[model samples]
Target chain A: MILLLACVLWCVAFRCHEWLQSRNRTTFPMPVRAVWLNQGVRALAPCLALALCLMHSPALGVLFWLGLGSVCGVCTSVLMAVLKNKRGRAPAGKPPL
Target chain B: MRDTLRVHMGWLHSWLGFLAGLLLLCIFASGTLAVFDTEITHWMQPEVPLHTRTALTPAALNAAAQAVEASERQGFSTFLSLPSHRDPVLRVLHYDGYEFTGPALSPETGTSFAPRETAGGQFFYNFHFSLRGGDHPGVQLVTFLGLCLLVTLGSGLVIHLKALWPDLVLLRPFGPRPRAWVDAHLIAGVLFLPFILFMAYTGTAIHARVLLPAQSFFSPSPAGPPKKSAPKGRLLQAGPPLPPLAPLITQGRERLHSPDGNLVLFTADDVRIFRSDASGPFLTRDHADFSRKDGHFLRSVTRSSPTVATMQLVRGLHYARYAPLTLRWLYFLSGLAATALAGSGLVVFLMKRRRSSGENAFFRLAEALTLTVITGFPIATLGLFWANRCLPVALTGRIMAEIDLFFTLWTLFAIHALLLCLRRHAAAAWRQHLYCLALAGGMLPLVDLLSGSHPWGDGAMLFVTVDALAFLSGLIALFAAQHLRRPAT
Candidate 1:
């Protein structure tokens, strides 16, 4: 039951994130090349957190996963913004292209 | 007036939550801990020996009641709670027309001993529902704050709606004003919105007895005495002597289909009633909670309304008692997040005031509030528990003494926080305050084990658990202090 709930929450959470980013496209830099490596690493965090917590306390595991997912998502998004700004080839904080 | 209402509600939510957030943070954190108040209480005082439940003989029960009644006749209402496996104490509670006191009565020996007035679990429970004061004004204030919370929640949602993705998928160590606030509010709010709404709505309704249509509906007019109905059946004249209540208890249990059900003998007469209603699940709010009111268990049923039942249901949901362990963990985590949201909101509001913004009256006020309630209250709470352990057992008026200890510590911390805030080093003040919190929290269990009559047995585990949680939280706050010290990257 928890697994199902977690999966559903993850799907909905990702979709919501996508929707919000779509609305504020100007300040956000486009993934210049579909950076799978960074996104994959970010996605692994929640999975690993869940796996580790499953042994000691499954409930704590859920919290760990959720927290890890939230942290990773924020870091990568900020990194994308900073990296794009540094390349100097990026568009000035434009109205969505 | 319409615009004023909108603007005031907006301002009310913003400032109330922003100013009260630190206190509310403590309230929420403590409240979540209160779910297992009794369990925690038992865990805290492990010295109370456990005994197997033997059959309740008429003689033993009668003796217990007689003892309780004698105690009650001194201008206090009294109760005798039967022993259960989880808690071996036969709970006896009485109000001496001025204050409430409870003592544990041993069913095996029919001897009563005053339990320590340690606010351990009840502190969290009482603080949330009644804010450590009695009902009425406290409930009213908390309800008012709940409305403001709703407003803050709505505005925070609006402000964070643009950055919801980063909130979900992002973790930034450094950020600009709006971005950090937006991210903090988004993650905190979205994740805990359901829990917060449930808590606020249910908390408001729990005291519906004092508010709205219920109060107006039930209140008698001041001009006249209540009009009485004509008597029915000559009021049953006089009937049988109280049939040795133990037999009636057995009969009532058989009828109720659950031996676990309790029996109440109203007035020790023929009007004996047995109740075994399911107080376990969704039925908790039912005034017919056969488990709670022993004497009037049956009579209360006819007078109850659907609204009362619905309100109780909300109360149960808000308290999260019937929830399974997994769901409880979810609620606890969500509660912590809610506290974070409230705390972060205050931090954001304070941060927005540039040093040049006229020394920002609001910023100074926020800093003061954060210090007093956020730091001071926890210190006071810790002290109250310490007093429970340290105070001599022969000490009288235990309840008032404990509460006084809490307020005294609170006042002291508030004064200290104010003095520190005056020094114009708000961040450093917070760090120092957190160190004090850590010291007090870390010492509570040790004090309990060392000072109390009871040894540091398995029973003290609750205190240990709470102490550990407090210490971890204090460490987290210390880390936060460090984070605050760094210049914005």
Candidate 2:
């Protein structure tokens, strides 16, 4: 269960931009759809992680895992930004293309 | 009012959050540490031998009851606490007008253990509420700031609500300073909005009881004139007859239907045995009251009522007494994010003003004070740990000495940062203090190992968590110091 949750979370988290970028305006004219999709995955990944915790941990443990998963996702995103920047691949200090 | 609604909300978020942000940082930071206050207290006082998970024996209860009586004769109002999963030592504690001060005992022999006299983790816990001021004044200030936080949070959402979805996972830390800070702040603010709002609301609600006038909350006239209050918690003359605690424990357990019942409060007339609710994950106010005189079962008190249970739940959420280790860590992490939210908001406030308004005295002063509070607090906290490790155990008021070191070091560092800022050495100040934080926080384990009273060599992971966390925190600070802001080009 933990491994499945991790796989799902990592897939949704690291590939979030790809999910966004793949949304061509022709099929999804409203930007809200892409935004909703991004938000859904980000939100769902934590819930999935917490669902896994609920199998073994108590309710509060599940709540903690939920919060932990979200914060870790954000922190990992930040770390990825820095690492990408260090590798000279990030388009920092400029608006998104 | 500002020209536009968004502009006005932005202004409100910046000023209100910035003004209260410093206090919030300390409040939240201290509170984060406080989530593990008891665990940290256990860690700081390493002399109290860890107990195997066992129920309290009747002999142990009698011994602790006698000890309580003896302490009461000395004018201390005492209560007995049985072993639980968190802190396994039996303890007899009294409110010293500041903290739970008393003796910890072994359940087998019921003899007291002499742990070191450090302020322990309660200092952070109390400081989180009152900032070490008298409880009334401190509570009022904290509440007012909490209200301000609510206002700031509301206005911040108004400004950033539109971008919440679009920028859900975007963080560009390597961007230019202002942009990076904005993105970072937005990400934290958006991601932890529920937690931020809940903490601010529930925390204030817990402290908001004082806001009501005494007359409003209580009946001015009761059914009868209040009976002359008995001299409560008084120790009886030696060998005063009392019922054995075993039956009460058994009965309480039978009534509550939870095996892990603990005798929390003891008095001449009655004793209270608290146990976690079977359906609830963590603990709640579910207990059975037993008469101490004859060990007769009194009515059980359960917070299953919606109104009473809700209030108790809010209190539980605030104090986190009900949390297991996992929930406690979640509370701790959310608290750190809340601190960062306050911190990055403050930095962006100054960065925007510095660029647009130019570096005036007010901006420089704010920057210095920000640097002082943000860096100085950790430095001070770590210094307290070092003082705990280094201070002579036999020294009178050794705990006070550790507390004094915290304040002294924090004040000195703040003043130094301020002076350096005045000399236009902001970058240097940040770098120096971050290095100091790394040093103070990193070297704690080695210091603990040298003290020989530590649990590091003893292979107890419970006690070593504190040292391990400090080392990790130090490493983060060292990494941050490496990336200290370059002077504005």
Report the Cα lDDT for candidate 2: 0.75
lDDT of 1 by residue, B418-483 (tens): 766666667677877788877777666567657755654545555566667766766776676676
Off by over 4 Å in 2: A1-14, A17-58, A79-89, A93-97, B1-3, B212-242, B261-263, B276-284, B356-359, B455-459, B485-489
| Sliding window of 10 residues with minimal summed lDDT for model 2 chain B | B230-239
- Cα displacement (angstroms), candidate 2, residue B85, comes to 1.4
Measured with C-alpha atoms, the lDDT of residue B35 in candidate 2 is: 88
Mark the 10 consecutive residues where model 1 chain B has the least summed lDDT.
B232-241
lDDT of 2 at B163: 68
Tell me candidate 2's fraction of native contacts, as a decimal between 0 and 1: 0.43
lDDT of 2 by residue, A1-97 (tens): 5634654574466445433633223322447776788867866775676666666565564455556555665766676576556766554545321
User: What is candidate 2's lDDT per residue for B402-476, written digit by digit as tens?
Assistant: 889999999999899889888878889989999999998799988988898864544388657888999998998
> What's the number of clashes in each of the models?
8, 0
